[model samples]
Target: MNSRAPLNTAPPGMAEGLPVRFADVSWDSMRHDIEYVLVAPQRTRQPLLVFLHEGLGSVTMWKDFPYALCEAAGCRGLVLSRWGYGQSSPRPGHEKWPVDFMHRQARDFLPAFFEAIGHDTRADPPWLYGHSDGGSIALLHAAACPGRVGGLIVAAPHLFVEPVTLASIQQARDGYVTTDLRSKLARYHADPDSAFWGWNDVWLNPEFKHWNIQALLSAIRCPVLAVQGHDDEYGSMAQIDGIAQEVPQAELLKLDDCGHSPHRDQPARLIEASVAFMRRHRT
Candidate 1:
């Protein structure tokens, strides 16, 4: 059975208001504990905002951004480290992620995760705030379970694979081996190799090149705010543009002088835009 437990304590650099917690979630079709942090849980009735991290990100890697956004939006926030990220269980070395990993996350893991945490999405659908790979997962979830989602604020979400993205993933592979990337990632992930290779290997796999989700975008019925960096090295405007094309009601934001991660590169602007969007659609 799944259970909830208090984390030992906040990480050294975690913001004061956010309290970290752990939820034993049934993941990978197996029982696994996931690390998460709840911000402003006192605002229980407020619209919930769930933050989904980037591919290599975890609850700790998000730093204070979730807290900052939750405070600004006057909403409670749920920031979780996916199964193989952060303080959560490391991916088994013998296992390799399939190309449909993101699909499984949105279709399988997410619903179970909410149930494990006692969140009734049907009664009170939550707003999704996702970045990069997380953004794609949000899109897929919203599409798959439209009635259970309030809205979406996705940044740098890839609807289709791009040549530039593949190149950057290749570069990341090189950095992980030849540079200090592994050491840096080790600071956040329990097993750096687990986190790194789990994501890296799948993206670099030849078969994964055909992965795309544009067809599913039309299934999304909720309002969407798609954001992207003007200077993103991994993807071009086409990514967000494709989202707007499929999800016609979707609003788009292209930040100036920003790279891949708008939350880290331009937090204030992202917060302002996100807060405004939340207010507009607040239930």
Candidate 2:
């Protein structure tokens, strides 16, 4: 997070949180204890919104935004820390994520996480709100499990790799090495190394440069609103513009004077756009 970005304080009334377990999460057949939090669950009659965090983000990193969004949208929310993030199971020291890491997350881990939390996507699908890598994951999840996603609000999501993306990731790698980034990460992730290295290593890998999911977009059968900032350092407007190319039903939103994290940079505008979009497609 930029020093200028305001910090998010977790609000009151978090329900059914943490220490949820799921088995056989990967080829290694490792069991993982995924951490999660539910917000405003009392609104059972309303739609469910599931939040997926950024590459370096954890459950705690989301702070009160999930609650705030749910409140404004009159929806319930399920926020989770994916494996190797937040207070969930840390990545094995020697392990490296494959180029298909995001695919694995969307195809396998997400479904399992949903089940462990007792939210059956098929019986009652939920709207997905994601940022950065999380946004990509949400798209992949909706594509993979067609009818299971009610809708999506993906901010700064990457459908294809780009030189700018790699360059920014390299800058982050350098920051982690020469700055207090690791210490700052500790405030959110239990194992900052696991969180930082896991995302950094794979993204900087040569093979990952070719990673792309644009073809998967056509498979999505739900409404989608792709948001991006004109000043985003990690990617270009091509990210959201490319989304409109594939998923014709998807709407595009570009914010001015905002960076990568729109929810942090332009919360009011993002929230207003999201609430209206969610309602337009809400059942």
Candidate 3:
């Protein structure tokens, strides 16, 4: 985050959350433990919003937006760091994320995390607000869980990896390996490589070029709002365009002068659009 950027509207809530361990899956002979932030609003059973962070993001990286958004929407929230992020355990240095990383995040890991957090997704699937890679995961999950999810808000999601994406990711890798990017990432993640390669290598690898989730978007049955900025460096309008095309009921919001992070770029507009979308989708 730039030092000159405006501070988050609300201060980050306390980060003293307890650790949650998920069973039924193993990574490196270890059952992963997830660190999460749960915020329940006053009185209503207002929808539960689960925030999925970016490829290199952790719970703390979200700053205060989750809290602010939850307050604005009068909803509860669950913000969790996937394994190998934030306070979660680190992935083995030699390991590489599979081509199915996003799918596992959506179909396998997410359900376990929510279950561990006491959220019975079978009864009430969450309203997912995902950024970047997280946005992609949200789309997959909503599609896989069709009738379960209340709604989905995907900010800068990718249905397919474009050349532009690989270029940007390659640049990021160079910055991390040769520049001070590691120190910078230290502010957000416990192990910067866990943050960096976990995203970079997979996105830039040759085999990942064929990775596409357009079919998953077509499977989504609930309301979905796909927002992106005109100036996003990682992807273009085609992302949201594909979503609208694949999911006929999907809504689109394109912003000017904004980049990859819509919530950070235009907080007020993001909030207004979100509130309206939620209301439109609520049962």
Arranged by TM-score with the best first, the candidates are: 1, 2, 3
lDDT (CA) for every model shown? 0.90, 0.85, 0.80
Q: Which stretches of candidate 3 lie above 4 Å from their native place?
A: 1-29, 41-44
Model 3, range 100-171, lDDT digits (tens) per residue? 899988987877666655667768767999999999999999988877688999999999988898888989
Query: How much lDDT does candidate 1 score?
Result: 0.90
- State the lDDT of candidate 1 residue by residue for 73-134, as single tens digits: 99998999998899888889989889999999999999988988899999999999999999
Q: Per-residue alpha-carbon lDDT of model 2 for 158-273, expressed as tens digits?
A: 99988998999999999999999999999888899999999999999999988999988988889999999999999999989989988989999999999999988999999999
TM-score of 3: 0.90
Worst 10 residues of 2 by lDDT: 1-10
- With a 3 Å backbone cut-off (N, CA, C), the pairs that clash in candidate 1 are none
Q: After TM-score superposition, what is the CA distance of residue 167 in candidate 2 from its true location, in Å?
A: 1.1
| Residue 131 error, candidate 1, Å | 0.5
Could you tell me how far off, in angstroms, the CA of residue 79 lies in candidate 1 after the best superposition? 0.4
Best-matching candidate per TM-score:
1
Better of 2 and 3 by TM-score: 2
